[model samples]
Target: MKLKSGLMGTIAALVMGLGAAQAEGVKVGMITTLSGGGAGLGVDTRDGFLLALKQAGDAGSTVDLVIEDDQQKPDIAVQIADKMIQSDKVDMLTGIVWSNLAMAVVPSATAQGKFYLSTNAAPSQLAGAGCNARYFSVSYQNDNLHEAAGAYAKGAGIGKVFIMAPNYPAGQDSLAGFKRFYDGALAGEVYTQLGQTDYAAEIAQIRASGAEAVFFFLPGGMGIAFMKQYAASGVGIPLIGPAFSLSQDILPAVGDSALGIKNTSSWSPDLHNAANKAFVAGFQAEYGRLPSLYAAQAYDTANLLLSAMAKSDVADADAFRAALAAADFASVRGKFRFGPNQHPVQDIYVREVVKVDGVLTNAIVGTAMTDRADAYADQCKM
Candidate 1:
């Protein structure tokens, strides 16, 4: 009886040790813009990522997230990245909104042998010659939506257009992308100061530019302020932009001013796909609001990580990266795949802002570009 009892005790100890090993999860550091002007985008990213984990239940337990606020500052984001890597010992890093912040963090973090799964902010630089194998953008490249908008404008027979974006890497990419696909004449192209609230001066320029349409990419609070002021200014020239400025995050605040405005995006609330429908419904149920493109991207990033974790341990860098490259998860954006540069190669759609059931939201109006790949893919050696 003593011998049998001792054997059982040894078995029990082994079982407990196995359980502890299984419970060890991958540590992920999320540094995002959670305060100041761009708080909404970061909040949505965090909420959506958490929602996916919540929905996953036990399967999501494989990931442990250390989240921090970057306050929409490049230096702050870099500092948080360092702390996350050195102190928290994160296996991977994700969640940055602005292109400038991404530019500041992604290169160094990936260089340090930490994988970066970008939630947003896919700058052209990273997509091109500067591409790294350890970096993957779960979101569309910065140029994609602008390219879609440009295509939409050309299809709509708008001959002359005025383009404007914040004076940042993304802003530069936005206008450059619009020009890439836009065959129309440019009346004016203005680069506004990043986070500039008042658009009175730009509005005056637009009013005098005689452009048929205006394409702008002012994200977060900057967009909200611009739209409100533009609407009041009565710059009868129709305004168009990407989903960053026209999504559920900004539409409610912009009110009726955003009504009937055509914009480009890779995902919309009305996109009919099993994954997307579930994501939209789940996000609304979880957060009591519709998910924006930022939220959807972050949610997809989380699921991507979960899928990879299911296949291999994060400590095995090569195997984990291979798992991530496979992208064996249902994306909220439906058809998603990484291009050679590790940026998304997906369809872009045009969405119109419409009051849906007494709330402002976006609805898919048309498909702008299909199986669209960024122009910089060939430049990337990786």
Candidate 2:
């Protein structure tokens, strides 16, 4: 079921009665997974985006936000994108959580002359030959953290490793990203069904593979289920993956099972910086929880849009695009810049899950890669 934001309803009513001058400022439509198994990721993305706008106060009021739940279905996301572009006439689109949904929506949205400021879901296809001037990812490419995980694995001296991910575009990128850095024997490689909860078979395979470590990229509820089952199954192999698989959003559910698991991320709540400190405090004050990587990216995406709006009118496509490309906003990730493909060029850090004051959270343990640019950036002609 597609759910519309109540704030969007109020904004739509206000827009209907206003003349062009009265209905000023940018109209943004957000299509994201807000239901089913992947709700946590989408919820965090939505909350983070809104939290940034909320902090903007008067500046935030310049944006008329419209939100819709994609329900984790590609077809549903496409339908929403079409409505937002053709009917709603939004100036831009943002806030898609899953890569599959992003694949369904981004290209068509940008082709129709609407900018897509991605909050998450930066697939390699969009970052490479499929790049568009109007498409900008506020988050890292899908392979970035996975690549860092691979580097960590290589540096940690794990001779043999078993890897797994969901069978999807992001999953393909995940394993390929790991292989790009890890020059080690793969005891086993598996691609489980996307959104699959049961891991009995996969765990059995990991046990028999003689692997010294296991790396898997399962996000949202999938990760929670897998981690719980893996811990219960008595598999002592170290678990590793990108932050999405072990971020703040899932840590509470995964509980002690996630302790000591090393994950790679571009941002963490414990990150030392002025912008990050405010973001973490504000997120907890607003939502009563620590912000996840998804939240940090979404918060940055909102600020990026706001900053561009301040410099150029969205109606002026060229000027507005240039404003966005400048990336003048302070990112919660600290040092953030767009690569040639409009994907992020930033540091990826290794984090170990730990309890601080009995709350499950990740602590930065080491730097995995610095000033890392995705391998596919050179392939992007734009």
Candidate 2 regions exceeding 4 Å error are: 1-24
Task: Locate the minimum summed-lDDT window of 10 residues in model 2.
Answer: 15-24
Error of 2 at 271 (Å): 0.6
Q: Give the TM-score comparing model 2 with the true structure, all chains together.
A: 0.94
Q: Give each model a TM-score.
A: 0.94, 0.94
* TM-score of candidate 1 versus the correct structure, residues matched by position: 0.94
| Cα-based lDDT for every prediction | 0.91, 0.91
- Give candidate 2's whole-model lDDT: 0.91
> Per-residue lDDT for 159-244 in model 1, tens only?
89999999999999999999999998999999999989899999999999999999999999999999999999978999899999
Residues 1-382 of candidate 2: C-alpha lDDT, one tens digit per residue: 1235656855885778643323247999999888998998888999999999999998898898899999999999999999999888899999999899999999999899999999999899999999999999989899999999999999999999999999999999999999999999999999999999999999999999999999999999999999999989998888888998998989999888889989999998899999999999999999998988989999999999989988877877898998898899999989998887888889999999999999999999999999998988888997
Cα error, residue 192 of model 2, in Å, equals: 0.5
